[model samples]
Target chain A: MLGFVSGIDRDLLRQFERVSQQMERMMGLRGANGIRSGGVNAFPAVNLGASPEQVDVYVFVAGMDAEKLDISLQQNLLSISGERKAALPEDAQVYRNERFNGAFRRVVTLPEDIDPDQVNASYRDGVLHITVKRKEEAKPRQIQVN
Target chain B: MSENKHIEAQDQENSAMQARGEPESVMLPPVDIYEDANGFTLLADLPGVTRERLNIQVDGNDLTIEGEAAIDMPENMDALYADVASTRYQRRFTLSSELATDDIRAEMKDGVLTLRMPKRAELQPRKIEVSAG
Candidate 1:
């Protein structure tokens, strides 16, 4: 009887492991919809806001050179790409490393009403702010009642 | 286990703080620490943080880093979507006695903080010259 109970416990543990593996894969797939291509955690997360005149995008990234950043808009898709170089010397002994260091690209889908030619980007305090003006026809107008 | 030496992260305290019902919960920023023959270097990523908002304090053997990220929202703009929840960042570390706390230098640029903590003169390794008698 004891042997049979132990066998059941082992089976349960294996099933749990399989479920967790599937969950991880699902997370990777979900990332592809918006922020990243195929990764559990997205790099340089962004926030989007819109006003009547324009749309704003804020990207959070630290320790990056402004000249090296690449910001472009093709149709309604905006892509931000750059590389974060390591800070420490090659011979130094690393104790703990939690910061993300490498080349990364994040694509964001903008609204259809935005004018791609009027987009402006600026980097300040390690935050990238992109402002895209709305099309002239897309702007809301206050019509007078007859 | 043997590799875990020098700086010790205060993870238990972080969890405890989260348990309490604080009005503004702090998020720990990711960090990278490395050691050389003379001292240790620490790098922390603090996006959206300005120089005036950053605070660093060292009391006894404890070192703390705290900062507040300012999210700029224009007057006429309304947020359509946001993923970042917290703007406060805090992290603490227990530093070893071998480090020279008084001589520590800090610099912040592009929202990243770099700290250089050198070893005390007496604690650093020294080479002795041998002569024939």
Candidate 2:
């Protein structure tokens, strides 16, 4: 390994290291849709919003078939997995390639106060919307005046 | 020299406007342009854009596609883990003279927009027959 490392030019090795670091920073800093991913940068960009009674989760996954998408909930973690097919024809010559197409998995940790049984999800125009109702006990309660 | 200086000043003013957030941020949506026997096909990834808010226009040889995504946020909701943000989708494509720009067809489904630009009748291939004289 040391001999192999020395075989490459020092300047080339330095450039490679710099590029790798830059790639790591890019993947770590931004989420799928260029938003600030809190901790993990998964394939599908996700947004988690909550209301007083429920939590709403939105996943940005374009060109995905509805029947092929899979969503699972385990404890406080929600996993979304699916594949996006290439849109161009096989014989066509590609000019610009930027869209990503492959099997992807995104695991998001939801709030613990959510009710697992009451979770509902829907897909529209390529965005997956998931709504999980919060537990009654977790919601704010009004106190009675004696 | 005066005209060049005037152009430089205009460029500086435009950049200043961008820095001040006066101009909307434009994102380059990933796109794939393919050419085949027919003409050309363009596929763009535009997530969260609904049909009602999507628009496609063709002027001369320039084609423009724009869509607005209105992300539904619950009242008093906070983002615990956020990655994707709602934004407008805009892109432009320049067509060659060989293509029939007026007959271009566009369709949006599952957040992916597909545009088919057919070739002109004269540009299509035609087989010729030869006879011995």
Candidate 3:
């Protein structure tokens, strides 16, 4: 009887391992598409805010040329993509490296009230600021009592 | 040459904070260090930090980098979402006697800080010529 119980336990453990492997692969597929999976260690972290008139997005990235950054908006989806060159020389001996390099893209979905045609972007001090104006109909108005 | 005796990174508080299960008050910026025949180059990514807010100090053999980032929020704007908590960045390092601390060059551009620390003139690698006797 003990031998049969142990065999059942081994089988259950193997099933758990298989499920975990599949879960890892699913997460990897989501990360490869540059979609924010709410991972704490995502590259080029961002902060988002909104006001009555406009929405603001703050992207934090360093050592990048502003002209090379690509920003586009389709409906309510905003995409920011760019490539960061390596900082060190090819022949130099490296001691430590913690910086992110290579190509990176971040996609953010905005609210439906945003006006895609009224967007402005600016880069300053390694931070990119994107502001999108809200539609006139979406603005909050104080209703007067009759 | 086998060991890193010239420069060593030190961050005791950051580790202690993690151990104590407390939130970090200051952020540790990512860095890259590379060595060449002449000297060592240190690059740090300090996003949102401007030149006027950055401070670098070398006291004895201790090197410290401190900076503050200002998040510009327009008046009467509500922050719907925020991932970054702290805007302060700080890191420390210990330098060896072989480095020329007095002659270190620093440059800040696009929220990145580059420090070039050269070796002492006498400690630089030199090639010896073999002459026929």
**Comparing chain B with the reference, what is the TM-score for each candidate?**
0.75, 0.76, 0.75
- Each model's DockQ? 0.53, 0.63, 0.57
Measured against the true structure, the TM-scores of the candidates, in listed sequence, are 0.77, 0.77, 0.77
Candidate 1 per-residue C-alpha lDDT over B1-133 given as tens digits, one digit per residue, 9 for 90 to 100: 5335322344555556668855456778889999988999999989889889999999999999999998777789876655556899999999999999999999989889999999998988887879989
CAPRI grade, predicted model 2: medium
* Residue B89's lDDT in candidate 2: 79
- How well does model 3 score by local distance difference test? 0.85
lDDT of 2 by residue, B22-102 (tens): 776555567889898888889887888888888899899888899887677777998766665437878888889999988
Candidate 1 chain A lDDT trough over 10 residues, lowest sum? A31-40
Per residue, candidate 3 scores C-alpha lDDT tens digits across B1-133 of: 5345333322466566678998558888889999898898989989889989999999989999999997788787876655566899999988877899999998998889999999999999999999999
- The residue pairs that clash in candidate 3, if any, are none
Error of 2 at B63 (Å): 2.1
Give the winner by DockQ: 1 or 2: 2
- Candidate 2 residue B57 Cα shift, in angstroms, is 2.0
Q: What residue runs in model 1 are displaced by over 4 Å at the alpha carbon? A: A1-40, B1-23, B128-133
Give the Å shift of residue A141 in candidate 1: 2.1
Order of the predicted models by DockQ, top scorer first: 2, 3, 1
What do the candidate models score in CA lDDT, each in turn?
0.85, 0.82, 0.85
- Model 1 local distance difference test score: 0.85
For candidate 2, write residues A38-66 as lDDT tens digits.
33335677888888799999998888888
